[model samples]
Target: MRIKDLFLLLLLFSSLLVNAQQKEIDSLENYYHYSQDAKRMEICLELSALYRNIDPSKGLEFAKEGITLARHFKDLKTEAAILNEMGVLYRKLGELDKAMLYHKDALVIFKSTNDIMGQAYCFSNIASVNIDMGYYEMALEYANRSLELKKKLGDENQIAYSLRIIASIYHESGRYSEALPYYNQAMDYYERLNNKTEKANVMLNKAIASSSLHDDFTPEIVDSLFSQAQIIYERVGSKYGVAAVHFHRADWEVRVENYTAAEQYYLKVLEITKEIDAKVLYLKALEKISEFYEIIGRNQTAYDYLSEYVRLQKELFSESKAKEVASIESRILLREQEQEIDVLEAQQKTRNVIIVMIFVLLIAIVLFLLFFNQRYKEIKRLNNKLNDEVTHRRKSEEKLKESEEQLKVLIEDKNRFLSIISHDLRSPFSGMYGLIYLMEEQYDELSDEKIKEIIDRLSKSSSQINELLEDLLSWANLSSGNIVFKPEIFNATKLINEVVDINTYRLQTKDISCRYDSSTQFIRADYFMVKTVFMNLLTNAIKFSDSNSQIEIEREIIDDRIVFSIIDHGIGMNEDALKKIQQPGKHVSKSGTMGEKGSGVGLLLVYDLLKKHGSQPEFSSSPGEGTTVKFSLPVK
Candidate 1:
């Protein structure tokens, strides 16, 4: 095609792109004005991100509006999300301090809400800004932390992004070889997800890393990679990618002493950077061009480009400082407006006083009687209002105190539960770790039978660990009100049989037998919670029972309530222990006949659940006399 024809086509494409973007903005604006409540807040956030690159000032304005609306609605999640968008916008505008401030603010919210993914993203953003400021150590710390979190979340795209960030950190620190592995890992993940834009981005960086590796890189291979990345970027219309590729190519040409080719590539980089409004890339391209000219002995040309680069750098710095000043001025204006309101109020009070004084003498005698009556009425009304306010405040304080006390109790229970879990967890984990270490060290000298024995021990430890974790999570969910309580009609016998089957190993280990008479009754209660209660009761019975003992589970309909009991023939507790078990927080547990561990956490959980069901456990036990625990639920 002719040059003029190509130019016309490009112009048409640019016009169409501009028109499309404007239409999107207009549609969103209409929706924003017409929307209400959270919808309007959401539109504001959307518009904020849409305008972030095209018009940063407008983006910041929309972001501020979003934050205000979210705060008014007490929507912390929306507020945190908007804060992150504002941070990114500020970063794009080159306000690094403001960017970091917003990110840290969002981080506080994310941490408070326990949003792991949100926290990870915040850390990654902080690291990006730190990298820009040349704080490599801080950047590395945040990036690594983000990578670890993303890994745990098992989000491949996020993990890839994190890996890419870490690679860039290494690359910036001149550890090209160290960066290569991470870049490759990120590329592989992106490829597997079929993320064209991100995959291309990783490819470009990987190429750059290879180029920087000097003797380890083959020029042909690096060039091929760069070509592939550039094609993908161009296909995707990524201006940043295009600019980056051009700059890298210019650098490579300069390194190989191809002055003419380097000049052409540098000029292309500058043009693309200017088109994209990327000040940093444009300045870098100018600096690189100047260096190339100086090396080629064109001193005058080099000086002119050098001066332009310095001028642009200073202009960018001045713009950032001006923005900071503008922000401070805005805050000052808000304070001034508040002060103006105070002055207006004072003037109104003065006017009222003057009017009262002028009218005081007109009806002196009549006014005296009228004033007394009005004053009395006013005092009566004020007294009543004051009393109501005092009562309301007292009530509010009482509720607050009650909530605080309840929260404290829950926290203490959680701590105790966690302590038991940690101890239980530590035993299995430490055993597995030690056993694995032993096998590894003695692999060559150990017999096959010994290795098998070690494997068996590892499996047992793993099973114990898994069971403990499951119980811990279930209890935590139950206590935190996260578990949904849905009552339904279900056969009690089936649930009991399932619970018994689950504990078959323990039953067999103790050479114990369980007997239960199946009932055809349906109960109206939370099936899961009821099942958990049964499981805990049976577990406790088995733990306390001796080898070859019998555990009897029975269900009886008494006065329209289904009563369930688990009777165990084993060593029983004394009066004090029984009393302690019935009381809250005083869970007195002892080792079983087989030296099995007992935390009593399970019993406490059962007690709370039973109370929730409008009943309590009836425990009867004495030394060597055995124990019987029973609870009741409403029948359907």
Candidate 2:
């Protein structure tokens, strides 16, 4: 059949599946109105699970309702189940951190309840979230834990699921050879259970892995596997599975140099993914087709497809979508507050009834008037205590509001930091692309000198990108608190000289001379951190210095501390610019004297490393003269 006809059939099949799910949801909602307490919570959980793939927002609404009911009924198991389902929904929505939080919360409850099965499920969910967040090692660890738990429980189906997760983690981490055996084991289990959809998924993944193995699996064998998976997917009416098969088939074709077949397969993937509204898959298809076009020298077509892919990606992760997610969370919180208010109102009504009954009894017993007066006084005192508690709660709420505001500021800073990194990274790639395109399209028309200059520019751009990436990674590690400060006695002079030697090429390029006294100076500090600080400072000095300029590296003993300084006859910053650079969370980048690029992450990293060692770098600079940076470390 033609690919278009095949996609049409797939679309029709997907519509049927969607309709079936919708009908089931409607029936559950109808039954929910007639149910009470636990049954209602069960319905909510079911609906949430059903809506997870179709509409995560709707799933979240149902999950919230389920959580409220489960808590009211004191059903910890059900609450944990709902929480896990909510995590899955959030993962689908691309809120990975939120998903991880929900999964961890579910795991805690499962542990408290001693529910091994629930705990296994939570581990698997957490593994899935870690996989989404690109933490493959953590994902593998959790997946193995889940598999062990499933094995202990002797549940073959759950064990198979865990095996699949483990295999996927390996696959995503580019350990396809290791992933193959796990996929085989999972596929065997699904085959034994006669689970056609899952069996097809495993077949597809196995085929992809095999294709990536080059000579290990023949092209014919890979083709046979794809055919088998497609047959099963069509029989099960799984359009997603079929689309995935087509996407990988395209990749296999490209690997085998069958460009025409790859193009057709890619088009089929796009059509099927778009028809089924599988946006992530659709985006992948768009990106692959763009690359495919570029490889075939169809530059305009490639550019068009790339533009579309970028637009779609931005749309997927837009600020407006982030705000929508925030709105959903806010609404959930509001609902919880409303539920609390309802409970309080019910308690207040019961108390009022009790007080009225007591008053009536007191009216009948005039003999105990003194005792009644004393009781009334006690009740008034209790009321006053309740008021005091209310005031305290209000104050706590105010503090919580302040904390939330601070969190918002932090989030904004994080976003801005990411934006700056993105721009800096993109600038070099953009220049490289233009240079490459010029080389490709007009190589014959250009002179040897021009070609050499273009190559040099490409090299420089690549170097800048590399430097930015290194700085970015270091900053990320520092910000995440992954870098440990392991202080040990080390020769400060030697470390400084080592850093200076590392930048020897840059210094020679600028024709700048660096002078340092060769004196042994021992200091207690993190060796790697100190080295990084020295590297950044010296590199910055080299970048900003004029040709034939002098840089002095000085060390002085002051009591129990050793002060280190790097001074350069460079283009110095003004007061305003220096202030901005010194401030925390401020990313400042400017061109050097020779038009060299920077990511502005170097100094931030320097500041953080020094801060960890109980010191801070002080800078002195004016626009015309030079700059000096000094910091201290313990001599003991």
Q: Each model's TM-score, in the order given?
A: 0.43, 0.45
Error of 2 at 562 (Å): 83
Error of 1 at 200 (Å): 54
lDDT of each: 0.77, 0.80
lDDT tens digits, residue span 1-636, model 2: 122232333344454467789989999989988998888899999999988756777778889899999999999999999999999988977779889999999999999999999999999999988887889999999999999999999999999999988987887776878998998999999999999887887887778878877777788878999999999999988778888788889978988889999999999999988898887678878878888887888878877776677567656645534655454444344344444566476833322322332333333334234433553453344233334335434654574566457556546546645676569988999999999999999999999999999999999999998988788768755753458789999888888789888999999998988999888888998998999899999999998999999999998889899898999988899999989887866778899999999888888888889989888889899997889999999995
Best by lDDT: 2
Query: Compared with the true structure, what per-residue lDDT tens digits does model 1 show for residues 1-636?
Result: 122222232333344355667789999998888899889899999998887645666777778889989999999988998998889988976779999999999999999999999999999999999988989889999999999998999999899989988887888788888888998999899889988877876787777778777778898988888888889889988876777777787787777787887798889888987887878678767777887887899978876776677568557745754664454344333334444456487833322322232233223324334534553453344233334335434654574566457656755765676577567667778889999999989999999999999998888777766756667667655764557778889888888889999999999999999999875778888888888899888988998899998999988889989898899999999998888888866655577787665556677778777877898899999999789998999999
Model 2 misplaced stretches (Cα beyond 4 Å): 1-19, 54-65, 89-102, 214-220, 237-240, 267-287, 298-636
By TM-score, who's the top model here?
2
